[model samples]
Target: MGRKEEEFGYLLDNNAANTEVHTKTGSTDQCSQHSSTETHKSLESTYLGSDDDEVRRSQAGQSCDYGEEEGHLVYHIGLLLEERYEVVSTLGAGAFGKVVECFDRDKGLRAAVKIVRKFESFREVAKSEITVLKEINMLDDDNRFACVRMLEWFEHQGHVCMVFELLGLSTYEVLCQTDFLPYSVDQIRDMAFQIFKAVSFLHRNKLTHTDLKPENILFVCSDYNLEYNNDTKRDERRMRSLDVKVVDFGTATFDHEHHQSLVSTRHYRAPEIILDLGWNQSCDVWSLACVLMEYYLGQTLFPTHDSKEHLAMMEKIIGPIPPHLLKLTSKQHYVHNQRLDFDESSPSGEYVRKHCKPLKHLQRKSEGERQLFDLLGCMLEYDVSRRITLEEALWHPFFSPMRTQKKKRS
Candidate 1:
């Protein structure tokens, strides 16, 4: 293997659970700290409106031009926000805006700031995210799933900025660093426990996290950059060891609202979302099942971007969608009279989907394999009403061993 591939393989070599590497303890002082080597540049913005309600715009040549190109608000380094936090680096770019690493002068801490575009729609969504975050914070004091905490929010430079506690690399990054190798069953269990617990908390609070993909799931540790020699070696020796937290509430909504049915990224999106069926917290369970399968299989369970194609792949893998669920959908373009018709005959005289791969490794009849199969089946049930509850999933025998071990440790 080449150097990059070799480094990726390092991430999948170990399967033992490392306690230190999986600590979920949170600290107020556990903020990010930047190295002095990182560079910063000054920012100049054109001002508009009154002193109390000024909207700032980045000066030409100093901004990322995100606003002009994709309608997202532009951000620049060295921008002093709210006379407190100073932008140090662009952390990541997304559809709304960019997440930047900022230094808080008063708190003497580093934070991740998510800057939303000043567009009215974007601002409204961003406001909703803040509202959801506050609700989660007020209710979840113990941080059961280690969900990301919002420090504060404000308007800065024609953007709605949200300050969050800095988090580590995402599960997506972990998979990529491992060259998409299938994670061990033990590791998958650990992640599922944390994720399911988080989702259960949200559901109990009457909220739904419409997006639940690998990128939205993050590790709690700081130094997750596997490029570092020491960190890489240490992580390789403790493969699948991570303390995970769910992030991104921009698309979340109260279950009663029923306003968002088209939320979630395309690949991990639930069937309800695609068929225009009004969804509740159960939709997140379907998305979570897909993510969990991806961890064990090292690939997305359904990989099509087109709605019809995605539905077809689902049928091939999980069997037909329930007629009742199909009837609930407002959009019937993907569903024909509560039925999906397709030519199933293949060259091998067995039905096969062009996108889905055969489950070779899962052919084993081990206890762990059987348990996972059952858990996935429950989570991916066709009818939302029949789907497994997060609480039930937590107590499921698939995770019973882990729960017993955790109890013994406590």
Candidate 2:
């Protein structure tokens, strides 16, 4: 690895900048394949089937007796690993594997252990997540950034278990429990500020969180209050603390990594990804924009999953895509005459026209609301080159209060 890459534990892919991702490798399954820097290279090697003498020597006493629950690693409540982490209960489960709440005997605290599935693909992705997390831990040892802290990791049996700081409910879980009521402007400000700060920090380090969404954004403490809502004629849940952290870095990519053709959950996907025009850090900005919008509205900003309809909806909400970008896209089937080709009279087309309206319509005359939408506009800019970077977004008019508060504190 180059010195620059070694310094950061990853190098930039100069040749892959315009290298379009051509597969169905969206954020759900996409994982980084770059070699790690010297700092965490051994850690990666150990967790990724330590075959070398140094790695095998370092991981000498660890057990290799892992069994699977369906496709995920099997772990029962009260099961202990390394005689340090005692399983408390299952936190959640998905394709990646299961996250179990563990009692950390050594640290005398709780941690969330992500037991990766045994599949080759899943294990590889988990290794990638570990690499990124180790890099994040090294980069932000002071914990100034809002990304989740991976306390440690180890291979148990065949499962590469990752121990994370047990956090509160994901924003999606809270939003669901609250019956889909949106957050107040002040609340969104606090949460978005932290999220943007984290993204800025990652971008500064040349990492891009390709799958950012509400579910991936979690509260550090999800304690909330039940407040009466006159308009909804029922009680609504209000977050007691707006503090949040970004999670799920299995798809996080360094600038030097191979650019996956598709990334991000469908609703939050950037236009460039859909059009196959290639992407970079700006894609993170676009997903962040969708995420902030979801927090404000208590629902996904873009509700559909179809590519053509999604583009049509984008046109309806944020004006047309620039013809030059349309012409440049490798996804020619989705474009015609330097414009998105779609039937306006079709049922899907009707759905687009019905579900989406101009961004102006979603805003009110209130300064906060106006400024928030204005910021979203800059973020959702069709031209990736013109979209506001998180660093720039942090200084927008909407976050004036955050800046002022910082000034007061300093």
Candidate 3:
């Protein structure tokens, strides 16, 4: 590698997460020698605005063109940010903007800097995210929860820049790497425990994550190995660290805040959200159910993007939406004659039938599987009132072994 590239810090793949690799780029004398590294195969979260009204981002080079190529600030390689973080490479990009990996000379670590679009709407979203992150950072000062930590923030060339501790791949990316094989019940249990603890902390603080899909949940370290499975006769990759954090707080809402009629990603969305029935923390639980189910099956339980077909999939898997819920829905077109406007003879109806089955039928006949499905049933309850909260879910039999471990430790 050329000296220039080395000075820019080691550039890895688009998604590889790195850490502690501090290299001195001639611009600064603060940087130390290179240290260690890790892999983050992907980043799927979006960050959106401003910490202050005065610290305006740069206006010339780019909002990623400053406005020429949409709102992204044109990423100039090796550009110095806040005089402390030097941009190395683009790690990922999304609707919000882009995230650049930078070498933090002050801390001797690699950081993921989220660059948000300068558009007013995007900026407002970014501002809201900053508020939520600030509250979370204050509440969890010791970092006990499994949440992505925001180390700092700044404005540069008209873009809101959020600096976070570097993390690895999204759970979805890891699932894809494993060739879509189902995660063992034990693996799911461990992952789910950490997820629940993190989410439960949010609920206790009166906040709802609103978005909880596998793609939004990320591993802290994606380092892994390929192990030959004698039974499956396939080389399966096992993650070295199951530790994960829920990301993308751009959509998280507090209880007293106005609830958007629609929230969460299509497949992970709750019935209450789809029906426009007003929701709360229970909606997050429902989304977690979908995420856990995906981990168990190695694929999305409800793969459809269409809201109507998604409802059909849910009905097929969990049973009919309660009459009260259907009766209360403002989206009247979705119902006819007091039933989902689904015709058993229609092509779409057949498609739903071909793809879905009762949740009980989808699970293997093992005690652990049964227990997981049982907890899922509680979480998937159509009535938000009846749906299980993350607190209650932690005590469910599926997590009994985990609770036992905790008890032994205490």
Task: List the candidates' TM-scores in order.
Answer: 0.75, 0.82, 0.84
* TM-score leaderboard ranking: 3, 2, 1
RMSD for each of the candidates: 12.1, 11.9, 10.8
Poorest lDDT segment (10 consecutive residues) of candidate 3: 27-36
**Which structure among the candidates has the greatest TM-score?**
3
Cα displacement (angstroms), candidate 2, residue 176, comes to 0.7
Worst 10 residues of 2 by lDDT: 8-17
Structure candidate 1, residue pairs in collision: none
Show the colliding residue pairs in model 2.
12-256, 13-256, 21-261
Q: Write the per-residue lDDT of candidate 3 for residues 1-410, one digit (tens) a residue.
A: 45332322221212111121222211121111111122221223433221111112221111222213577788688999999999987765554577788999898999889887778767777778889999999999999999888898889988999998887776766665556666778879999999999999999999998878776777888778888889758666687988888777877889999776666765677888778788889989999999898788776677554567778889999999888889999989999988888777886677777767899898987899999999999999999888888998999999999999989999
Give the Cα lDDT of each candidate. Answer: 0.62, 0.70, 0.72
* Model 2, global lDDT: 0.70
Best by lDDT: 3
- The better-scoring model by lDDT among 1 and 2 is 2
lDDT of 1 by residue, 1-410 (tens): 44322322211111111111111111111110000111100010000000000001111112233225465555577889899999887654433455667899999999877777566666776787789999999898776666788888898767888888876666765665555655657778887898888888999989888767775777776233333236224233144346888887766778677464356656567787778776788888998988888777666676433466667777767877888877777766656767864445742213234445444334346778788988888988778888998888999998988789899999
Between candidates 2 and 3, which one is better according to TM-score? 3
Per-residue CA lDDT of model 2 for 1-410, tens digit only, reads 43322221111111111112222211121111111111211111111222122212222222222222466666688999879999987654433456677899998999878787676666776788889999999999999999999888898888889888877766765665565667777788989999999989999999998878766777888889988989747666777788899887867889999877767666678999888888999998999888887777665666654677778988988998999998888888988888889888997777777767788898757789989998999999988778889999998999999999999999
Sequence-dependent TM-score of model 1 = 0.75
Misplaced by over 4 Å in model 3 are 1-43, 46-68, 231-236
